[model samples]
Target: MKLRTLLIAALLAMPAAVTHAAEPIEGNWKTASGATAAIAKCGGGFCITLKTGKHAGKRIGQMNGAGTDYSGSITDPETDKTYSGSGTVTGSSLRMKGCVLAVLCKSQTWTRL
Candidate 1:
């Protein structure tokens, strides 16, 4: 009976372990413009907090960004707007996407740096 209980407990814990083992998005990525953006995990998702710009050598403030609970966003710096988005870590790539205003924006894939 004790062995059976132990087995059941282990089985129940497996899913949680797997979920916790999921990879986090915390690295540098190149934008479509060839600019580098720093991504990090936040609010159960990920966010872009920095980007390459004219002031590349200057210290810029953090990017006020947010993403979904299991996804992230790639913002357009020029527009100062963010689309709804999510991301997945696959191999050496961070696949992301965002919905445009009243439009279905395609996934924007970024390679991990």
Candidate 2:
């Protein structure tokens, strides 16, 4: 009876565990320019920062969304400009776009490192 109770308890707890689980992007990743960054949970969103390379110790962006699609802002530390950015993550790949003045924009594909 004890064994059956334990099994049932474990099964029932699985859903709750999954519901509070972290997103797939909650880990370290690398950008196309060979810059490394870490993505971690920040409230209802994710905070991404450059961990090494020329953009070292800088936060390049913060994304708000779920699954593989996210919308947020990308900041250029050099220009001190922040743009409306959107990105999609496919497998180990991430494609991001940032724009200023609506028409002037740039995009890059970052690989997971």
Candidate 3:
């Protein structure tokens, strides 16, 4: 009976152990340019790929870290220029900033979709 109880307890805990919770940065977002971008797990980090507009199917960003903060590179699909970028996730919004030389920086708030 003890062995059976242990097996039952383990079975009950299996879902909690095997299920992976998504990070705050994982989701589809509406970019400042009005394009839909999908952020998902890729290798060691997250890959941001555009899903709409002229830049559809383009991978424009990569970020590392979990929870509400991330750092990586972001590319401007219009200009094809890459910049150092960081992101902050708050509620349903993600504020993304890109910089040139770490002095000139621009930011945009993306809404989760």
Top candidate when judged by TM-score against the true structure: 3
The root-mean-square deviation over C-alpha atoms between each candidate and the true structure, in angstroms, is 6.6, 1.9, 3.0
TM-score of each: 0.55, 0.84, 0.86
RMSD of 3: 3.0
Which segments of candidate 2 are over 4 A away from where they belong?
none
Tens digits of per-residue lDDT for model 2, 5-85: 999999999999999987766677777677788888787788888898877889878899988898888897677789999
Indicate whether candidate 1 or candidate 2 has the larger TM-score.
2
Clashes of each: 3, 0, 0
Candidate 1 deviant stretches above 4 angstroms: 1-22, 42-45, 55-69, 72-74, 101-103
Clashes of 1: 3
Residues 1-113 of candidate 3: C-alpha lDDT, one tens digit per residue: 99999999999998997678899999999999899999999999999999999989999999998889999999999999999999999999999999999999999999999
Q: What local lDDT score does residue 59 receive in model 3, on the 0 to 100 scale?
A: 99
Residue 107 shift from truth in candidate 1, angstroms: 2.6
Candidate 1's TM-score:
0.55
